[model samples]
Target chain A: MRRPGPLALTCCDPLAAVTNATARIILICSGKGGVGKTTLTANLGIALAQLGQRTVVLDADFGLRNLDLLLGLENRIIYTAQELLAGSCRLEQALVKHKQQPNLALMPAGNPRMLEWLTPEDMRTVANLVAERADYVLIDCPAGVEQGFKNAAAACHEAIVITTPEMSAVRDADRVIGLLNSQGIQPIQLVLNRVRPRMVANQEMMSVADVTDLLALPLLGLVVEDEQVIVSTNRGEPLTLNGNGSPAARAYHNVARRLRGEQVPLHDPTRERRGLRARLLNKLGMAGN
Target chain B: MALFEFLQRLLGRQKPSGTLAKERLQLVLAHDRSDLNPELLEQMRREILEVVQKYVEIDLEEGDVSLETEDRVTALVANLPIKRARPAALTAPSD
Candidate 1:
């Protein structure tokens, strides 16, 4: 009998290569630290799950893993990715199920000292295993363009760069994008995080258009600065879960929908506050007349 | 404080923090992308001036060399005024 063709290969194909034609691997990377890469990864995983996509988040930052904490699954992590890879535990045993969302799960990072044992190829192997059981695999990459970044990005087919409006963040993002291009990662998207509309309106900050122009990549979405983010983080609940209709939560949902090929109008909802104020002023003027 | 800020804004002497950040980032990023630091650029300028001085007497008082950027491309541009032509022996055409 003739051997099965490449086209016949599926996620169920046990012989499929790591990062093969199985699932969409998205690496959330940022060159600068404290730019909300982990937060975006956690909330985005939930948002994707909410959209009916089975999502698995892999905290690739071995030394300083925070995805588990972001998802409020830190205390629940029984087995880490290191244990799974070492064959000490099965892949399912390593997955920490989301308490509220059945479709979402997380594979926490290994020990920092054990980071030396994991390579880019190893990351791809682990990602392939997790991707086999999920529709999407979002890897929370470590900050900077170091070994950790290489390991995180190795198994991914696409990348999403998160940056703030600060020139420092954008410059680092440009360098990161250049590095990603050199790595042969295609279809990289930009997430303008922590955008302040008041600053942008006053020409004090870079607008979405300015950022997109400099980076020259398709924008994934813009996440406005919201206080609810801190609240959700403090409670270990993702902002996408109990965001109570905050702009950041909606933006995350829209980003997930856009990932599923939905056309979302690119509008900054934070800017709507100004429009409302103008309408209120007009009403007050009419009433005065 | 408010009056001072108002005067600063009125005189156009106070640049918005955002604009300042953007301009500063642009300059730093251009230097970073080119992998050319200010010290290395200065050294290169000195060497270029030395080479040009051999061909003609340069107006060192006004000559300048700078790294200029257009769009995303960076170039080392040297602008030197000729004070006098060199001797025929120095600038003679090769056979």
Candidate 2:
């Protein structure tokens, strides 16, 4: 059903020679929905690409796949992993390379109707094939600890569990971490998302400490709630793409750097908010004098 | 009332919502992670009481069995008040 063309493997050949190290197949997952799993996947992919890592983001959330839309590659998807697995298209044909960042490519999952036909073995096959050419394969896992999550976990060597500071999110993250542990996914890390520094300062919301204490995972990065994230999502452009220096964008970049074994310090939202307030107070005092 | 409230806020005497959240989460997660619901815990308490009653005179009303999580490790902590040792248990041969 597919043409055995030499052209399929030609595009990704340069990266294989660039790095001898095997690609890190990481799963980006959260047990609860609306906690920014896809958002993290999109931004992290762009960040890793900017760091010169040839990255392929595999959208494993077939039932409610929107990773293509988030990365702004929705219209360019001609073939998907389903077609590639079915031998209807080549790997290069199915991969939708980012127009802005050529280092990054997206393999969007097929329609929800095909969800029933997909299995964990199919996911591993796709991940292994993509891993052959890239330095990173990020599987955007679906919400919940269901079959979709199992399929995604089957393909990853490690995982990044994203969660908000809310009670429900943290509880769900703990459960997901337990599941990841049972799956033998080593060195699992946590990324606390949508942190509101002012709220935390006022004791209105959970602090990063409270979350980390409960989840008991190594803190990978902290993304303070930035309005720019929503704007960039609507534009289908990840915040890291513009290098806008937004809080969330910086956090994402730091995550990528840390993944590269760089010892970048995690962001402290509480201290950041206090620093901003102190600077404003000093300026106001000077103006009054 | 308003002045008192302002003074309380200025002195930070009021319990913050974040602390409440943390306390609540600790209690709930201990149960959630242990996979031991309240009903199951109650059943366990009854069964434990039945087993212990045969060897000791215990205060069932004051007995407590609950899951506690510390350092990411959940433990089933039970405190059963033993009123007295039964004559049979006291007279049983030493192992």
The number of the candidate with the highest lDDT is 2
Q: List the residue pairs that clash in candidate 1.
A: A204-B18
TM-score of each: 0.81, 0.86
Question: Candidate 2, residues B1-95: lDDT per residue as tens digits?
Answer: 24564345445565456666888999988987888878999898789888788899999889888888876799988899999999988676566
> Cα deviation of B26 in candidate 1 (Å)?
0.9
lDDT (tens digit, per residue) of candidate 1 on A110-185: 9999777778877887787788678899999999888999888888989999999887788888888878888999
Interface RMSD values for the candidates, listed in order?
Answer: 7.9, 7.0
Steric clash pairs (candidate 2): none
Task: For candidate 2, please provide the TM-score of chain A on its own.
Answer: 0.88
Candidate 2: residue A146 Cα off by (Å): 1.6
